[model samples]
Target: MEGARGSESGKDPQHTSLDPFQVKDPNKLAINFAYMLEEVGKVAGTWARAREDAEPDAPVSGPISDLLNTFLQVSEYWRADQTRAIEAQTRLVSTFLDIWTNSIKQLGGEDEENPVRFEPARGDKRFNDPDWERHPFFRFLKQVYLATAQWAEEMVEQPDNVDEELRQKARFYVRLVMDAVSPSNFLLTNPVVVRETLASNGENLVRGMRMLAEDLAAGRGQLRLRQTDATRFTVGKNIAATRGKVVARNDLAEIIQYEPLTPTVYKRPLLIVPPWINKFYVLDLSPERSFVRWALEHGHTVFVVSWVNPNESHAEHGWEDYASKGIDFALKTVEECTGERKANVVGYCIGGTLLTASLAAMAQEGDDRVASATFMASQVDFKYSGDLKHFATEQQIAALESAMQARGYLDGLTMANVFNMLRSRDLIWPYVVNNYMRGKEPMPFDLLYWNSDSTRMTPANHVYYLRTFYLNNDLAEGRATLRGKRLSLADIKLPVYLISAAEDHISPARSVFEGARLFGGPVEFVMGGSGHIAGIINPPHANKYEFRTGGVTGGETFEQWRATANVTPGSWWPHWQSWLAAQDEERVAARTLDPHKTYLGDAPGTYVLARD
Candidate 1:
């Protein structure tokens, strides 16, 4: 083994360091392996500590135990065998070259403290590490050797799937020493090399991989969004083109109106509830991408309540105020618009949260004008909340509250940063590396562009939401009383249609499912594909999600109901549309803009088209 650890002379080290674990009597080799195990154990311990602090009530999944079992299995495999050795000579030669080139910094260079160093031929920003590109040939050599050595370790355990008798025997004799290379073994055997290597240059490798993947996938996804241009809405034409307008007046709160495409016969009125975090066009973004247009075209009357892009003036408005003024005022005006006793309502994201509160308030005081409450990406059960809670600490909340107090309103950029951090890989890192470092612009994405154009959250609204939803599970367990009335999910049970995205990191599917169960109404909970934007934009007529299944007899877990429910493969939208239509009537309602109550201006109200 000592013979293997020869001096670095830019040639294949003359000798190689044999793993001590392979020795029959070298107890020191066993100790070395133990040290590696300890290193991997520390990582697990850190994760466990974080888990306990993050969500103590949440169930510990079986996957963790399964992973640990695999780790143990690999360790045992490595300890017991090492007869047929890997042809690692080629790999060792390359690593030897790297060590020789780096030996200048190791011995002669001023950076003697640096264990790994290489001077760049030129100062290029593409390679951030200044001392990593000294010997290109040597670096390539190291990668090749490292890849093969790792491959050799892998082949020891993963016997090649060759049915040929002679070939299998030849393979076993020449390269079968890989019993030490199971998926579980890496943690036990290669902690120092893995950690030190990753720590030295992991950033560039991770960033490069992500950027490469993004670049490759961009064109394919672009085709999906751009190839489709069928409907009037798809071509970016809406009711505003035919017989409507988009008015953005500074008179009342941030409210947008998309009047009917044509006059209806019976005339049913409706209001849109958009989240404070975003400008309201999510419902009426573009013509084909606009749900608002769909509603208006179908003619049941529509008015979208876009949140006042909170400037200093609206800093004092809390959750209660949003519910009371934003929702209550909007509903009152909507009722007055068509002279309907109870107007139909639709809420998306946090908009749904406020709507649920309004319904609870109305239910408490007998105001069920919001005949049906559609919750899109809204969760009532805080018990199963996703990663958002990880960042919102009490101290952070206090800092935010104090900051918002000083500024009068939380900045749009501040809110945007938090959401971006929620999915840093997809939202921030790849584009950062590509556009900034590699000098490539981000692939144009309608959803991403919309998300990037953030809206300022009212100081009061932002603070209250964090405290109630993230800090404490108030709204989920029938505790959060927004405007004088406690809002239990059961309290707002009005033919609820709750939709959640399966791939959403902000709101996980299980969390959404649990929240939907809180509503005792005839709840039709849908699981859409993709993340937030892709999930919401899913039109039911398309072959998208295979997620919409039936509910259990009463409130039950997904596991309990998926057993008997009909397994269908497509978007849940058509099903939801059918259900909603069946609940009411199919009459083309005679909905004309109310002369006295209507804002009387344009299609996209100022609030809806607002950028931040």
Candidate 2:
């Protein structure tokens, strides 16, 4: 049999003598275990403090609990079955028997091929350690895990077993469970963790325990797994470093006017409305990836809304306030600063939803300040909103609202946790194994750093958004309203450009494509080549991903639109720039900040700097 430890030589370590004492020194291990116990005590103290601070007898089912209940309800479809149960059991046992036969053959040094064939999906790096392949015990564990996970997914996908809604929820919840229980997450089963534990003489466990305690304390009893080195990036210094000035400030947002990088600029200014859930720096992270910098260089006067991180005082703020006091206020600021009656607008994620609704209201009022509109990974229709829709059920939202009521706002970390869970395998578990299991600090990453910087959402706005948008699907159904005015997407007549990432989870491309047909004016729908952030922030210089573009005019379905789209190489930034230019080819000398106007501060204003 192969040795437990990996070898430098190409030859298998099985030929070498293995000494347990060499792997771990007994004396050192004992001392480290004592240290680990001390950290465990500290961790307990943090948990106690958290319990005291937590709301007593909080709602029965917050988001996490609600999801678990959904999983349970959906799981009844399989649990109640007798024949299905026996079939599942038979398949599982057969796979295990095959794995056993293969392990025995490998142990006996037989050259014959065995029947057990199980491989992780491509891009799965959980079992990358060499021991997982070389060591018989570890190889057996890998096969068992893969087989079980595949069986679980198969159960969820069984024909006519459950409705689509339950099936989707079941699939999502099952994946989370499977990922959380992976052999790679535990010390005994993971080859890398075991190796590290032995090589460190258990010192790694001590350090890992200390980190666990510190993180628990940091999140006030909740685990705030650090995804990146937070100390590496600072807003307005390295991140969100685009040169600009805050020209206007309101209760909801600060309007920032970026300095021009070109000698000439377009006649109309550009206003960006980013989702308030995260800091605005995502668009301005480092010079190389900064979308704000790219737009400035392309001869566009850029103005972005930096939403105030809400607190108890802002709890009363709702969707109408966000549309009027946020986007509308920013539009008025753009005109005041540039002396242009009309300006171009871009909204990202939920920001785009607000912009779309407000645009319709503006149309009803005969307000045409916005010349053209662009949506970046934003959805107006919720029929195909993906797993996120699972959290918007009437019961779940009510429970979440109760939890938020005491605090007046939904904690930023709470919202962050939801987004993280959407891609838990990549966002949650890797960091778990790296930081807590291996006792190592994560590498400094600008995107993850920005992701960690989340902002609170007012309870009123959050509840209303969940109810009106996700639950009722009122926006797409033409029943959505703002400030007592019935809003309809078809009422907005401005030429619109819509871009959706092909792999976006929060706003699926299908949902975004469906939304494109609701517009009354000419619409351009483009599909970018990555998930939400990477797809939209893809600068042309990187030349990393491709995009598909075609005019969206008819009532064709998303699949038909995709079939007819023309694939273009490289980033969609250039295409958007060309589209913007085509709106009006007129140009003028680049304008400087109005010295006579009252200014709040530099770009990336005070609101984005407000942390939880």
Top candidate (lDDT): 2
User: What TM-score does model 2 achieve against the real structure?
Assistant: 0.95
The lowest-lDDT stretch of 10 consecutive residues in candidate 1 is: 220-229
Model 2, span 13-113: residue lDDT tens: 65332442256587888888899899999999999989888852235456568667876776676678878778888988998998888777766555444
Q: Candidate 2's error at 465, in angstroms?
A: 0.7
TM-score per candidate, chains pooled: 0.61, 0.95
Evaluate all candidate structures by whole-model CA lDDT and list the values in order.
Answer: 0.56, 0.87
Residue 470, model 1: Cα distance from true site in angstroms:
1.4
Lowest lDDT sum, 10 consecutive residues, model 2, at 14-23
Task: Write one digit per residue (lDDT tens) for candidate 1, span 496-535.
Answer: 8878877777777777788776765778877777777678
Q: Residue 69 of candidate 1: its Cα lDDT?
A: 42
